[model samples]
Target: MADFDLEALSLSELKKMQKDVAKAISTYQDRQKAEARAKLESLARDLGYSLAELVGTATKITRAPAAAKYRHPENAAVTWSGRGRKPQWFVDALAAGNTASDLAIG
Candidate 1:
């Protein structure tokens, strides 16, 4: 591994370096996964079984539909599923003295 003097790099140079490192890591990970898949396929062939037969084929991920849980009173378009972080509109409304239940969808 080449030694890098991080302290000598300017802020912009450091950001560029960070992006480059991230991209390199992503590329390396993808290559490693492909190689692993190839090796597994080869082994499966030798064992008289297709890769899909050995490891079941990929299944479609099914998630229950997210229903609107909260909506902006002023704008119907602004709504939240209430699953993750509260949206900015919801926070603002709450700060403006509106309770969470007030925004609940029927």
Candidate 2:
């Protein structure tokens, strides 16, 4: 976050800030997910599982629990799902005209 420049923005200036921030967050998350896939692939190769097998397993998505059964250390607002698209709630909030930061972990 130190790399982020978020100083001196009026409420009216927040629109552009919001757009930049959303893109930045999505890019960062995508990087994390790709890294996770690569690590898993390397481990699979070491254990005799083919990259194809590892990738197939990774591509499958699992639904989150009904309540708060997950946690994210970085930002409580950001839940942990092994890295993917924004969760449904976040998408809904965005669609309803709320910024990502408007949501919280707890």
Candidate 3:
């Protein structure tokens, strides 16, 4: 049973509610850590790599083709065309050899 009315909670009651939410978040984080640790242990056994070896291997992996983040040169920075579809020059660049990926900032 609740100690206080739900509708009539004062500032102190709100503080207590916040503390309860924080405790719940802490418990959830602890549970997530436990689950991640268990998954890593199983994955390590299957891969025949220690946790440290797995991390070291992961760090060596390069970006994939689909995930490639390309950027144009700074000299290529445009004089901003006010809104709407890309300007004719931009379309021409695409039609020429430049890829949308090559122009992507991220």
Candidate 4:
């Protein structure tokens, strides 16, 4: 590494140098990460598995189907899984003084 007289440098020049050093470090870190990832991928391929599979990130995420938790009173076809936001029908029923238990599916 080259020695520099940092104390002799003007404040503006020091700031510019700092910025340049920061940029260089960032670029070097990015290159290192890319190289590491490439090496991992190569090793994974040699092991007969993809990078994601080797990391256990390639597994398909599956969820059990949502069961009908609440059914519309007037329309049996209309249903809510009661997992997320309440449906407008459920809200309307609540506004009209119908309890959530009133719409519970068997």
| Cα RMSD (angstroms) for every candidate in the order listed | 7.4, 20.8, 9.9, 4.5
Give candidate 4 misplaced runs (Cα > 4 Å): 1-32, 44-53, 58-60
**Highest-TM-score candidate:** 4
List, residue by residue over 1-106, the lDDT tens digit for candidate 1.
9999999999999999999999999999999999999999999999999999988999999999799899998999888999888889999999999999999998
What TM-score would every model get versus the actual structure?
A: 0.54, 0.41, 0.43, 0.55
lDDT of candidate 4 vs native? 0.94
lDDT of 3 by residue, 1-106 (tens): 5486767888899899989989999999999999998899789989897777767644566643343233333445553232456666656667888876666655
The residue pairs that clash in candidate 2, if any, are 76-105, 77-105
| Poorly placed runs, candidate 2 (over 4 Å) | 1-12, 54-106
Give candidate 4's TM-score. 0.55
What are the lDDT scores of the predictions, listed in order? 0.95, 0.67, 0.68, 0.94
Point out the worst 10-residue segment of candidate 1 by lDDT: 77-86
lDDT of 4 by residue, 15-96 (tens): 9999999999999999999999999999999999999886767568899989999999899999999998999999999999
Please provide the root mean square deviation of candidate 1 (C-alpha atoms, Å). 7.4
User: What would the per-residue lDDT of candidate 2 be over residues 1-106, giving only the tens digit for each residue?
Assistant: 3664446767667887788889999999999999998998889889999888755644667776545433443357646342556677666666888765555434
